[model samples]
Target: MDIPFIDLDAQEKVIGKKLEGAVETVLQHKKFINGPEVSVFEESLAKFANVNNAITCGSGTDALLLPLMAIGVGEGDAVFVPSFTFVATAEVVSLLKATPFFVDVDMKTFNIDPEILRNAIIASKKMGLKPKVIIPVDLFGQPACYDQINEIAEEFSLNVISDAAQSFGAKQGGKPVGGLAHITSTSFFPSKPLGCYGDGGAILTDDKPLAENLMSLRAHGSGKNKYDNVRIGLNSRLDTIQAAILIEKINILKNEIEKRNLVAKKYSEEIDKKIQKPIINNGNYSAWAQYTIIYENRDQLSEYLKDKGIPTVIYYPKPLHLQSAYTVFPRYPKNLKVSEFLSSKVLSLPMHPYLSSAQQNFIISSINKYTKEK
Candidate 1:
């Protein structure tokens, strides 16, 4: 029995006919770029996220870029972000020639720590860099501690960008993750919880002016008309075909999220208590992007599971601040202990809505057997 890390084929089989129909509609219309389907999907996404506007773009990186460009995040601007997240969060800031200051995350939540964020802001100011933005990531699938993060942002007069690339279907305090920040960016990469067939992304915001700016930024800075280029921008429109497929996927996303949660719950219940499981805060819900756990000997455990034909992965083997490309950026001055520690111990097991009871039992028993033998 081969267990998949993420059973995308199982999900595709469930929605294959609807997906084919959507693609066929796009093929017949032939309005491939910026077609009617794009707007429809954007509207649907905005409604689902409970945001006033949603701007679709080419990829999650582009989703992060548009907002930075819209708000003038350029050279010398200090952009704060968690070191534990995917590089794209900091990559976008670096692309704009801005300085990315790394902040460590809370060990339990695997999200940015607000107290450290305040200290980072103060440190940035002391270094003569203008503090501008805070990009808090919803690492794995859970929403960050937004209540405290928002307060810190307000105190420092910093704009917040929620990196919802992995947490789109998650919620905190009964509100969707996308609506928790000034601007939220999400991916539609094939592996995301509410993914499309190919690369895609969207930006959600309540500010109309910013939404207009995002639309302009995603299309070579077009203004009023296509030929009228106003500002420097990238050609990053989310294609119509992907949008059409996303429509079908989004309709069933709620059920999929519930199923993923069920899978996560079972892992917590049955996996060895010595392995630190993902922690979700009260009134918060994760999309369960990856059911990650931390153990002392993560490499040995991963290899052991691999030998058993159970796939596993590490979210980030090294913190963003320690990466070679990011070595020049300013950090918290003190060591980011938690981020660095998590980098050494985190392991993501098989997690998806379609994972079976038998498959999960095998994975659980295999792990229990290994730990006991050790």
Candidate 2:
């Protein structure tokens, strides 16, 4: 038998019936776009995140894009983002013709360094670019240091849009990820902690006016009716089927997050002490989207695990700053040494709520065996 990487099959076995019923209900209604379920899911999501409004969208990228469009980010505007995160964090800025000024991440948290962000903002202004927004990413299910980021944003008069695609169910300082920043965006791409069946995403915010603008921007910027186009917008509504599926998934998200934490604890406690484990800051609870560790010979370890029917993946083999497409962008401190170094050393092991102890034990033992020999 093969060890499953995410074991979505196991998750399906637990909630398959509920998921099927949700889909069936959507099919019966036959209202696929902007259906009743969409609003219901949005309300549930708002409540879960303890926010005032939640707006559903087409994908994670759209979730970020809609907010940028709402705030009118354009050319000469500089959006600060960590180079260690997924491209979508910076991609949305470039799509709007805004400058994506990359910043270095903390070696410990793998998140944007608040100090680096402040420096980047000053650097942008020095170069004659307007510092517009600060996009802080919650890398590997852990939330970024939002308190510091928010304070800096206030000092600089910038918006904070959290790229929380990997951290929907996570929390920091007893507050959920979606409510930690001025605006939060999360993905439901079937692999996140609280994922739906297909491509779906949502934006969360406490600012009611901003939320209303986002709602309009997601659906052709309509006002009063579909024919009334109030502003330039994109067709980015979530499917009714996917909304129904997410409703069921969200209902049990707390339980699933607890299970994922347990799985993470086992890996942290049992993995070899010599291998550098992930650092989860105090008062921050991770969704454990991926259980990543730093090993000098990451490629060798990954190949050895593959030979043993165990799976290992590198979340990012290359940081965005080093990529050809992003080379032209300016970076703070110029070097981005940490992000560049992590690219070669970091490796992600299988992580999900359905991961079992026996399977976890096998993975840990395999890793220990390989490290011992090395």
Candidate 3:
């Protein structure tokens, strides 16, 4: 039995008809750019996230970039983010000429550590840079320690941005992630929990002024109209076709999230003890994007799984500060022990809402065999 990772084909089969209808409607209308369907999709997204406003963009990177531009994040500004996440989280900071001060994440949750965040802010100030924004990543679909992060941000008078790129369908304290901070950004990449057929993303916020700014920034900084440009901005509009595709998927996202949670629970319960399973906090619900686990010999274990016709992946093999592009940036907690440690040990198993019981049992059995043999 060949096992695959992130079976997008399975999900496509479930939503294909609705997806086809949506795309056909867009094609018939001939309103490819900022079509009426785009607005409908944005409205549906905002309603689902329970936020007052949702602004769509070209991709997840643009979703992060638009917020920084709208908030005037520029040269010499310090943006604190986790080192353990995808480079895009900190890449945007550097793109704007702002400095990205990499902060370490908690070993258990794989999200930003609030205590280290406070220390990073102090360090940035000492280095003569203005601490502007705190971007906490929701790694592997688990929401970050937002309440604690928000409190620390407030005490320091820093703006908080929830990088819900992975945790779009997740919840913390019974509240959804999009409204967890001053601004929230999520990816609609084809592999994300709530993905479109192609590249897409959205920004969610309760602040009307900020939402309006984002709308302008998404275009060529259009003011009143595209002909009248107010500020320098990138061409970052979400394609109408992708918006149409996402509209159909969003309808059944809740059911998908529930199924993902069940899969994560089963993996945690049955995986070998030598493997450190994901630790989701009480009152926090994950979207279970990756179902990653930590093991001392991750590479060997991964090879063993591959030999059995089971595919696996590594979420990250290197921390941001250690990456070639970010080597010049500073990292907090000087040692950066947690982020570096996680990078070497973390390995993601095949995970998706459509993973069957038989496949899961096979995966668990293989891991048990490998551990016992060792």
Candidate 4:
């Protein structure tokens, strides 16, 4: 049998019955839009993340967009983001007509470097742009250096919006991802650690006023009634069926995260030593969204693994700043050397909660064999 990169089938075997029941319940209710399940899931999600509010949205992009809208980000405002993250991080800023000022990432964590972010904020101010928000991405399921990022935000009076698309089940300083930033956004894309069946995302926060605004913003900016348009907003509502599906999945997420960590631990211990392993900082626990490694011969290993029926993927082969559409945007330090270097070296191996021991051993040995032969 072919080794699947993420065995959703295996996950189904573990929770298929519950998932069916959840879906059936939604079907029985027939309230697909903004149904009862949506609110229940939102409450559960907020509790899981230890936040006061969790507002469900249409997609991960909307999760980021809703917060920006609530905060009134607009033209001439500069939102500092890591150059290495998915485009959605900066794309939301641009959609609001704000400038996406790119910053370099930390060599170890692959997250926005605090020093670089501070410098970027200063430089943006000098360039006559208003540095209003800092959107730090928690790359590869691990939380970024929030302590430093928060300090820098304080110094500059910037709002910190954590793009935690991959780090939802992770923790920093014992606090969950949702509570780590002023406003945290996460994705439930099918591939994420705690994904639902389809595109789903949520924004988490403790500020009730901000939460109220986000709730309004996710809808058509309604006030008192759906027709009472208070502010400009998008029609981004989480489907009831998706919410029901996520409720079942979220119940098992903690256990699944634990299993994922065990798999990551075994891989780290047995994989080739010459290839650099993911560096997770102390006081942080990752969701293990993808167990990525850094090696000079990343493409070669990926090709070799494919030939061996072992699938490997590069999270990103190009940095956002270097992308054609993003080339015109401003970048701190001019070069973004680390983001560029990581783009060339990083390769993600198969990662999921249901990876069997035998399957994992095969992947490790295959990598070692290639390392030895090359």
lDDT of each: 0.93, 0.92, 0.92, 0.93
Clashing pairs in 4: none
Flag regions of model 2 displaced more than 4 Å: none
lDDT of 2: 0.92
> How well is each residue in 250-338 modelled by candidate 4, as lDDT tens digits?
99999999999999999999998999999999999999999999999999999989998999989889999999989988999899999
* Candidate 1 lDDT tens digits, 1-374: 79989998999899999999999999999999989999999999999999999999999999998899988998889999999999999999999999999998999999999889999999999999999999999998899988898899898899999999999999999999789998999999888998887899999999999999888888899998999999998999999999999999999998999999999999999988878888898989999998999999989999999998999999999999999999889888479999999999999999999999999999999998888888
Q: What is the lDDT of residue 118 in candidate 3?
A: 93
Instruction: Compare candidates 2 and 3 on lDDT and give the better one.
Output: 3
Record all residue pairs in model 1 with backbone atoms less than 3 Å apart, i.e. clashing: none
Model 1, 260: alpha-carbon shift in Å? 0.5
Best by lDDT: 4
Residue-level error in angstroms, candidate 1, position 157 = 0.8
